[model samples]
Target: MAMSDVLDEGPFFHGTIADLRVGDFLAPGYRSNYRPEVVMNHIYFTALVDGAGLAAEIAAELAGGDAIPRVYAVEPTGPFENDPNVTDKKFPGNPTRSYRSSAPLKIVGEVKDWTRLTPEALEMWRERLATLQSDRRAEIIN
Candidate 1:
């Protein structure tokens, strides 16, 4: 089968707000975003590609793929706890709270911002994969 043919095999996945977790994710560029019925904690995401040439293949076929979104996760970097330290003692209204990651996060976001990846983005996929592999270890029990 042609390399392009392999890319066409079906059974794509989808994500929704209910699947949101406090971690990093890499999602395929599909329109059915995991947006939930109701807004909740925000999630961070990255896009994955094999290499520059392979990336081009994915891009070119994007218009024809299943269009089903995909999501993979990794450990989150910030304190995910809800702390009373600075929370308003008296939230007269909804009392709902929200927290966000530190600003000036990274360059991957630039894709969404620019609708394309710059050469600098070349390393992002490799870096994210490495980060995800950090916890893979042989178990040792006594």
Candidate 2:
């Protein structure tokens, strides 16, 4: 079967520290949330609300101080592909439901009801991200 056939449809979400309103466009060329040193070529998002929540929490933590984590319902304006960082390198498939698009993603609305990570869970994610940051071999597939 073709990989695209198995992908979920609709209800995409994006997580970030930036406060965005409906109709805002999220485009490429911004610094990556996972690796700030690299400017991203594509905007990343996921099909799962919880996945977006996790990303937002991490991004907020990284931004530090008074930054709010936010998840938004979004629509891609053009074609998107599976995020190779997870799909090709780690998961061997699009299990994360992560995707990237060179085109802009339009914010449809904010999602306020997604589950938030507990302090311990957040800390664990922090540690994991820290380890990845410290590892010279860990690279974001820009």
Candidate 3:
């Protein structure tokens, strides 16, 4: 299938239900409740412009892997954080923001902080770290 078509299906909404792993897309707390635009915001801010690597990760995440865990998909959204992809949705814990990172497949992940981790910013960093980890894991999976 075409890459765009898979992305349209959604990171969690792939053609095959088995292609999606029900993992935590966000961290917990204020960050846990971020809109998809927020994640996308970081993507642009972090300059995550590589689609080749991301696409592969989505396929792996959809396959349900614990070792190399990560969500993968081409961020179809241009440069608009408010655009809201598909992953931008209120999860169970955090319900204050939207979701982003709409892919044909994704990996479930736990949230954790980076070096400067605080109670307030823990969720933020956690999701960030997890996304990075997910990205790396996606690489391995691919």
Candidate 4:
């Protein structure tokens, strides 16, 4: 489906380990958080705050540093499409509310009150990601 056809009004969020302030623009061309070997062509965001939180946590863990996970309220400066990585690939539709854009995402504010995963849940996710990373068929549709 074309990106313009999908209608969603979002108070969107982007999750990461990078510390950013309001008015910052998150652009594409960075290393993939799930597969660091690949440079991403699109900047990803979600309408779901907790999904972004999970992404942030995973990114922080993968980076293996003292950095804390952060989620920021964002606005896409241009058109976006459903994230093919998850949409229809894993779920039938966009239950994840995830999207990607080649254009920059402007940060409106930092989201400080999102729920955090517990240690056990975090570990489970780590294991799952590790397995996905190791599987040869689990390619990112970059």
**Of the candidates shown, which would achieve the greatest TM-score relative to the real structure?**
4
Ranking by TM-score: 4, 2, 1, 3
Tens-digit lDDT track for model 4 on 1-142? 6766555788999999999999999999999988888899999999999999999999999988697999999999998999999989999888899999999999999999999999999999899989988987999988
**Residue-level error in angstroms, candidate 2, position 122:** 0.8
lDDT of 3 by residue, 18-131 (tens): 233344232212211223112222221111222222322332333444523222332224322222222233234222222233231123421121122245654554556457
| lDDT computed for candidate 1 | 0.27
Model 2 misplaced stretches (Cα beyond 4 Å): 1-6
* Per-model TM-score versus the true fold: 0.18, 0.94, 0.17, 0.96
lDDT of each: 0.27, 0.90, 0.28, 0.92
Give the per-residue Cα lDDT of candidate 2 at 102.
Answer: 90
Model 1, residue 33: C-alpha shift (Å) = 12
* Of 1 and 2, the candidate ranking higher by lDDT: 2
Each model's backbone clash number: 0, 0, 16, 0
The candidate scoring highest on lDDT is 4
